[model samples]
Target: MRTVAGAPVRAGLPTPVVTYALMAINVAVFLITALQAQSVMDNGRGFVNPLSGAAVFDSDLFGRWVLSPLDVADGDWMRVLGSGFLHFGLVHLAVNMFALYILGRDTELVLGRSRYVCVYLISLLGGSASVMAFENGGFTAGASGAIFGIMGAQAVILLKLRRSPAPVIGVIAINVIISVTVPGISLFGHMGGLVAGAAAAAALLYAPQWLGAGQDRAKAVRIGWIGLAVVAIVTLGLIAVRAAQLRSEYGL
Candidate 1:
């Protein structure tokens, strides 16, 4: 299987431990969503409301957890990060988890732990920013944005190494097509992730070389930490600024 292909380690390299852990966490979160959904459906206080047609998660715990643009504008900025881990439903969770496992495993190994984590957070925030800017509405959650970023990062490094990016580009193209054609899909989020992932990976791959520390694992780790900090700061700033604008314009 393609997923299995991404799992094996080579030349005594470390296993993709973080990748596996992330997959597990995603699954665990999905289980929570599922149970919550079931409770909502069972209780008379909830279900798909006839008026709004939105499922009421009993106490609305799950609903509150979504990346609500209005709520975000009110300073619930944590949703930008939290929403990446939340899925709307079972199918949504399954597909994203599958993609995460496949792409994350390989990317994690190639980038190593520190760099991989940095790329992921940056990409996730990128996607969140795009959604906040454009999608502007109820909660949108999924790991597709981050997964797309991983692919973009991989492509950037491969190109830098003079490797063929045809397969990677092909996959990205297909996904982009789907994002545009499919209903209820976040086109901006995917594109945001693509750009962010590529940018972060480029920094990781080239920054060290520029510093004359090419291939130095320790130096790479240091750069990864610094890069992550920079990305986090920039992301938070964007979210804060955009959220204020949204609040003012929309009166949230």
Candidate 2:
């Protein structure tokens, strides 16, 4: 088990408090959206009208909270973070929460709580930025983006330990395939999260060693944070650029 700043790795590790807290927040947000939507079971009306094959969330809260390029262009920047917590329906919420629970626990152990939070948030922001850049229009919502980031972080940890990353790669490949083939999935968001998460994890896992501070836990943690800040700044810059483009093009 690799330790960071007195935080032990996987073996007999402390409770994954941050992971649990994140899961709780996601669930609570989902419940609120479900209540507002008046339907928790179906993310879209496809269940109500299987013949139409149109997927639409029953909740109006989705529009206000979902990551919409137009809304972001209009300066609703909060949606970038808020949409990561909102879910379209029960199924969407359940799948994302399960993934978060599984990947987040190990990720929290590998990166420690503070670093784990940074990776998760940066991944979320990365996903939102990608959506803002490439997705011309639509309301996107779900934790899949952040979950994909956790997957990427786990892959980075495996590489750091000289362990095979085949399993994680396989999962990512499958998810990517689904994102491509699925009608409503956000491919850009998932890819963005994956790249951001891997980059953040790589920094947290390797920057200390590169800076000759691996043995010094305090310095290592500080360097890791600095690395995260770099990733965050870049992600924010991308968001700003995309938002400006949208505003300029749409005359918003």
Candidate 3:
């Protein structure tokens, strides 16, 4: 692809192809679901609206998984992760996918593919967990939470390198402003993802290491693994707490 400002794009950078693919998937899923919504409503067949606040925890596609909004309030717990993958409208999906493209490519370049994926998933989950914590009865759907997490990760990495984080901080601040000024945006989810991303990035990029002078490269790898572990534990803890809450509510 062509780079902006007439510069050639480097071929060796971590391209974030997976990130792009994820965006595509989210868009596609939203489109298909939207169409489905239209079809059902148009048919007037007395079909219950899946988008209804009541359908969330209902079993679907083999009754094995709970969906969002409904499950979020019903305390299905799993919906915290599942909800991140759903979107309410075209603009919602587009904004998130764009953010992912812009921030994800650079994060992948800095952290490599595996670590990049780890950060994204953790951030996504973190955002969802935040939503569950703060909002209990609304139908919330979007990728902003995960995208914020990625931004947080980028900021953490830049800070560790002693690079100026002014630009990034500015971007984050602007986004936060937009989120708050605009109606229907989940400020809680976005802030949650941002905090989670920062924590994960700090563990990954700045934890103390014990490598000798000649073993800097190896030390970096070790630190990354440790950071990943920390992030995983924290993320799982959040999910578990949400799950427990759900179970208690449902008496399951």
Candidate 4:
């Protein structure tokens, strides 16, 4: 039987619980934020009706949950994770949730639920770390970082299967360009997620080769965790270093 990362390719695999759960949570969070902000179609310029283009109230979620360098430096650490779930507006949330739905399914299929979650969370933190490092001031929020990571994982998995990763690479390139050119997009967050996702996926997919162990499921899982742990540690360290710099610079 053909296998992916030593996991047998079988029919009737379980549902992608993590992916759906994430989507639901994101939607729930957006509803709460939108209700509080008194607007469902919030945007950078302000909220608006997508159909009639009528102006609406501004979103308040960013104020509370966005990852701000100064706020992080002042020890608002939860923002690092919270920001990943926060979105600027309806369009932002819809785009990210769509990407997550598309990428999350295949990734969960290949990496399994647990490993996929590892890659997602680490990539999110990596994105937040990048924002802290480079974005001096202002707010950053959304799951684009995590979505980019999922895209990265798809690319890596294709390569591991000895297939051309041209498709995903093209997708990534287009998105990268958009990030660079778009006014409100977070380029650092996307790039950081891509790097972290690729690293984590590589660890999980290539764990057997690196560990010099046969394609045993148990051993592969263990080594994959080790790889993820390493990535997590590196991400946390970067966050710490950047936070310290901001604190010292701001005298916070």
Q: Candidate 2 local accuracy as lDDT? A: 0.83
Which portions of model 1 miss their true places by more than 4 Å? 1-13, 39-59, 211-224
Could you estimate the TM-score for every candidate?
0.83, 0.89, 0.78, 0.89
- Per-residue lDDT of model 4, residues 1-252, tens digit only: 434754445578768889999999888888878887777776322444799753343555555566877878888898899889988779889999999998898888787777788899999998998888888766788999999999998998999899999999999999999998989888998998889889888887886677886757677767878888998999999999998988898899
Q: Which wins on lDDT, candidate 1 or candidate 4? A: 4
Off by over 4 Å in 4: 1-3, 6-13, 43-61
Global lDDT of model 3: 0.66
TM-score of 4: 0.89
Candidate 1 lands at a TM-score of 0.83
Model 1: lDDT to the true structure = 0.75
User: What is the C-alpha local distance difference test score of each model?
Assistant: 0.75, 0.83, 0.66, 0.83
> Which rank order by lDDT, best down to worst?
4, 2, 1, 3
Task: Count backbone clashes in candidate 1.
Answer: 0
